[model samples]
Target: MGIILMFMLLASVTPFLFLQLKKTVFALVQTILLVGMWLYFFEVVFQAAPAAFSIPWIMFYASLFVAEVGWVMFIIRLIKTSSTVQESFQ
Candidate 1:
């Protein structure tokens, strides 16, 4: 439970860091963290007792979904922004 909460907190900050940080290494670290969080949540979902309707379980899945969406948006924005920069340079 503590670990899950910790991951939730970290996951919450990851998108902002991924989008705002200018450093490539920082973006890479955040991407790794995002993937790790998804895998950790996947394990929790599979190994936990059957309680799909429970409040905590629901929240966990909800957060996982939000994190995944954020990751996709981050990728799209990164590509769009990079392409615009390249176009401007050209």
Candidate 2:
């Protein structure tokens, strides 16, 4: 139940995150991965993927990879865009 909800949340939020980093090479790669992630999600959900594929394990790992990469990039961009720097400790 909770896992399904988290899946829905990630699907909802991914595109909005992409919009934050437009017109760059990293953004392009992120877009490709984003599309692939959702494509796999939909294919597996609809049972459109091939019969021999190990659906659950592959989807689990792919989901984690996509989520991690996306959020890490977002956080890095967030820090880069911050209005102030962290205080230096001498």
lDDT of 1 by residue, 1-90 (tens): 786677577667655755564545655555565655555567676876535665545555655565555566677888999999999999
Per TM-score, the best of the predicted structures is: 1
Regions of candidate 2 where Cα sits further than 4 Å from its true position: 23-64, 83-90
Error of 2 at 50 (Å): 8.4
In candidate 1, which residue pairs get closer than 3 Å at backbone N, Cα or C atoms, i.e. clash?
A: none
What C-alpha lDDT, on a 0 to 100 scale, does residue 42 get in candidate 1? 70
Model 1 regions lying over 4 Å from their true place = 1-12, 15-50
Give the alpha-carbon lDDT of every model.
0.63, 0.59
What is the Å distance of residue 44 in model 1 from its true position? Answer: 7.2
The per-candidate count of clashes, in order, stands at 0, 0
Report the CA-based lDDT of candidate 1 relative to the real structure: 0.63
TM-scores for all candidates: the values are 0.51, 0.45
lDDT per residue (tens digit) for residues 1-90 in model 2: 468557646744654566666635545554555555556667667876544446544544555565566677788888876634553421
